[model samples]
Target: MGKANDVQFERARPRIWDRLYPYLSILPALIIIALFTVYPFVYAVRISFFQNLLTKPRSHPFIGLQNYEEVISSYYFRSALTVTALYAIAVVLGVLIFGLGVAMLLNSNIRLANGLKIIILLPWAIPTVVAGLMWKWILNSDFGILSGILYSFGLISSYIPFLANPTLAKISLVMAHIWKEGPLAAIFFLAGLQLIPKELYEAAKIDGGGGWRLFRNITLPLLRPIILIVIVYETMTAILVFDLIYVMTGGGPADSTALLSWFAYAEIFKSLNLGHGVALAIIIALITLVLILIYLRLLKTEEINV
Candidate 1:
């Protein structure tokens, strides 16, 4: 009877341990995330309601909604919001178009497709600042490679000040952003493209489908989830764009490139208004969260349809 009882206890212990194993396995990751992401977000939220100026670091007072009010009522807030919206739209469009084009090209059996697969990721692998600077050099009005090429080809009379003009600066920023960020989208799109069964394409072709028809009816429908993902990801990235504007344009040329993130940096560092900066940051965070939630609903709808 005693030996039988010992074996029964041991069996029960194993079952109990197995029941808890999943949660135990995930515990360490939960701890780390709580320590890093959760703590920082909570702290930022706390800081946003205070009067924490860098010039008076020791005098952080709870000002409640004052910080929020001031930041919202600022002159540049509206301008920054408008610029961020336009910039995000341009960037998301440019990245989607460029990435989809590249992914389609790489998916093809063209002669240059293999070489492009290797080279397409180079810009993405490099740092954002480095990519921005490289583009800056290429677009420099004085002695820029692009300027010189255009001049040599008689496409222009002389060097073009790309970064000094408001419209051109915005365009250059978008181009640089596409160069740096489009590769990841291309890779995502390529993955989706590869996952599409070849039989579908073959069947569509047998039904007298042309290239455009096959793509429109079969490829596009299959790639809808991926396109949705790319749209959401690129929209967030474009809204938070900062490094390229910093390295290439500095939000100059009449503040044509002043994104929300750039505006936050200016508030914190330039204006020495930590409270205002954090308030603006909170607003940006909330806006992004809303966008993400909307996208998630769209994703769910897509899944349901599928």
Candidate 2:
């Protein structure tokens, strides 16, 4: 009886192991995420309490809230915040407006719709670094195809450095973002447009609703959910945008285009202050967190409506 019981217990142990094996396999992924993603975030938050930077790492010491204070006190930070706000607002609005327009246009009876979609998606599919480099060349003051065209059309006195001037720098960044992100937003809007029941449009027509009126009343209302999602998504992208600015201006022309992300990047890699870099990163993450909370609220409202 004792021998039989021991064999039964051994068999049960293997069954338990087999049942738990899949979850055990996922432990490595969890560890990687924790180490790379979660741990860095946690460390950044801790680092934000001190005054640290790249130049003098050896003399660094803990000064609670000093870095945050410095960030809030710095004129450079304020200017970057203002610039970033304007950039984000412009891109979000443009992407939504122009994207919806394109989506509506393509939703109609058009030949080669699939081909058009593939073409439009090309920009979004392009890697961000490559897009930035491509645009840098396009906006180059000398020997660029765009510059030559503009010169031929008598649009300017001479080569205009789009990435050099602060206003134009911001505009160039916005244009780059629009080119890359607008089509993606349009695709989302197009999906939403397709989901809308045609019967509603037919009913509106029966009631003598015209195109403008029908769109204002029906289409906009239906598209509200998707619009909210796109706004949140685009805003986050704009907030953390680094590639274009890095490639085009390098936050140059006297740091006029230095965004928060660029600032953090410089601190981390350029300046080699790991702790302070981590701190700046934490602040950025907090900003992102706030934005995410706002998105969650909007999502809840959407669910209530549904």
Give the number of the best model, judged by lDDT.
1
lDDT by residue (1-306, candidate 1, tens digit) is 255578878788879899999999999999998899988998998999889999997999899999889988998889989999898889888988898899999999999999999899999898899999999999999989999999999999989999999999999999999999999999999999999999999988999999999989988899888898999999888988888889999999878888889989999999899899989989998999999899999899989988
Q: Can you tell me which runs of candidate 1 are displaced by over 4 Å?
A: 1-24
lDDT of 2: 0.84
TM-scores for every candidate against the unseen true structure = 0.91, 0.87
Candidate 2's TM-score reads 0.87
Error of 2 at 245 (Å): 0.6
In order, what lDDT does every prediction score?
0.91, 0.84
**In the order shown, what is each candidate's alpha-carbon RMSD?**
3.1, 3.7
**Cα displacement (Å) at residue 35, model 2:** 2.3
